[model samples]
Target: MSVSSAIPTAILTGFLGAGKTSLLNSLLKDPMLANACVVINEFGEVGIDHLLVEKSDENIIELANGCLCCTIRGDLINTLTDLLARRDAGSIKAFDRVVIETTGLADPAPVLHALVRDEFLLNRLRLEGVITVVDAVNGWATLDAHPEAIKQVAVADRIVLTKLDLLHGVEGEDKMFAIIGRLRKLNPTARLLATHRGEATAERLFNMGLFDAAKKTPQVQAWLNDEALSKVHRHHHDVSRHDAHIRSFSLRDERAISPEGLEVFFAMLAAHHGENLLRMKGVIKLADEPDKPLAVHAVQHVFHPPLRLASWPDGKAETRLVFIVRDIPKQVIEELFSAFTDQLQGDAMTDKTLSLSRT
Candidate 1:
């Protein structure tokens, strides 16, 4: 049921005053994103940032709810479905990709879950990556006060530092670099970039290794580095106190998972901890498809459709998953994965027994 031409979607998130709208505007100006579709979510009152985007046609839809992750599940799905229909009908110029601009205070996990867990849309889309914006001037304080901000950074594939223009001559550059260092400590897999008033180039932002559908050496190296950082930060207590409620962890094993088992695992996870599961992304070796590793990426419970790569990147034939969760312990997730794997093995054994008895 997988479609070959499904477009990639990227989620853009940040804390309050991170300049996401400004960045979106800059990205729209690029010819590469000329055919890209955008979904912008606002907190309290819907503002005029939608009007500011000049290059793209007016297809802006606002999520009036506090955050798309919490309140706009139905609306989000229906809207995306409708957009796809229109693209199919050729009503709008065919868009190459979609970008979701989350509210300043939004938690990106649920939004990702919606993309991945939906049965109808699972085969129609792919999650490119998460791009989080951090305000250079107020990021440290925001991370300290708001647990959401920490979760945003923990799950980001790319972190953009904004408002450097305002930091001129105010001892801001040092503080910004310090924040970037902290971010690297939090999630070393994420690449950091600086932008002035969201004036970053689109080439530097989109198509970030998510759509290759093949094993790439750079991506494998990045994943390995991310694994190393996660191990190092697990013992670092100073960083833990800054956002005590949020944490990031990785799960890996040499065994391949059955598709049914994987589905059951994700369904149970979404049902039990959808609110706390901020982001999850990984490469898995499925039992039926050992030669082709499946890439799974999700925010909250929403997941983009699983993609099959041409070959294993770096020849690592293991399953590795990274999670950014809020108030969810690493041990809890580890135990959950263990229990699921055990159950899957038991089920297979019982099926084998039944077949032997029938014979």
Candidate 2:
């Protein structure tokens, strides 16, 4: 649904030496994340200690191109506070978006939470998305050895697999596939991209968050990744480890859903499995407004108001909702919706499979 535009912001994170810097350098060179202010953990000054704030001028570095990069000389909150003040005052160039690159071992939740903790920031900044980088060669080992890597993958909206060119032997190739399997098990909803030598397009990376996006039909289809989600859905549960317990599934409805029923369904999800819900978005037929389908999305416990499109995209009639969740079972969602409206037809499984309970 289209809402008041907040300046889009993205968090870039990965395990140590996971090509995060290379991605940041590449983004700085591009015009895609346009008119953006970047907050980075690294900027030539070698850090000496943890919890010790480095002292430096909080001056904004104007890139050769038209963008601003703020090196964090102090804590992230202080840096953001100063940057906002500078932008307001005429000390720095105006920017419409922001990108924050976290330290290799940093947990992303706190960084995201920081943006929301302050009411002023909540009004000014929108936590757009999380992009995590993984080195293909070392990725499998990294995931296995470090709990941080799994958490990073689990929270990401986009996961970039780097250093594919370095993978040579058949063994290495197999390992790469194995890594992909692990990623899918951890977070199936995230769009995965493979880049070698850091090559990608603006549309492929930027303007992804629903708030800033124009909400074109094609991008919606790409975000859903219906075919890939279905392919990954068949056998992901077998591999869900203790820490990496996540799954994705889609629902379909032949009968139109009334607005009241829709509201009840969303409320049930929030009250029942809010914490486990990662992302949910879909365009579906509404009984009240059948010709004008509705699009809705929710992240964690926050559900945005539904948007009714002028017309259905691509003349697709089936109502669909794709969910990327952590530990919430498919049957739980299915039964809840069925309780409110007509029997829900889960697109990801057969009738028998949909009846199965969460293990």
Question: Which candidate gets the maximum TM-score versus the true structure?
Answer: 2
TM-score of 1: 0.76
- Scored against the true structure, residue 283 in model 2 reaches a CA lDDT of 78
Q: For this target, which candidate reaches the highest lDDT against the unseen true structure?
A: 2
**By summed lDDT, which 10 consecutive residues of candidate 1 come out lowest?**
62-71
RMSD per model, one decimal = 7.0, 6.3
Candidate 1, 1-359: lDDT as tens digits: 44446587888899878888677666765677666777666423224354442343344432221111111334678878877787789865567778887888887766766677667666677676789999888988898888778888988888898887777654776886778767876676677888964445777676664565563535644643446545554445574466556666778878877788688667767776766776777788888888788877666656666678777776778888878777677766665565545554666655543332222
Candidate 1 — number of clashing residue pairs?
14
Residue-level lDDT tens digits of model 2 in 1-359: 12446677888899998888667666666667557787878765323222222233445566656667777777777788888888889777778888888888876766766775666676677665789999898988787778678778877778999888888899878888988887887777787887774444445666555553335655555555555666764553445354446667888776787787677677667776777776677777878878877777676667655556666666776677888777787878876666545534555423433343222
**lDDT of prediction 2:** 0.70
Full-model lDDT, candidate 1? 0.68
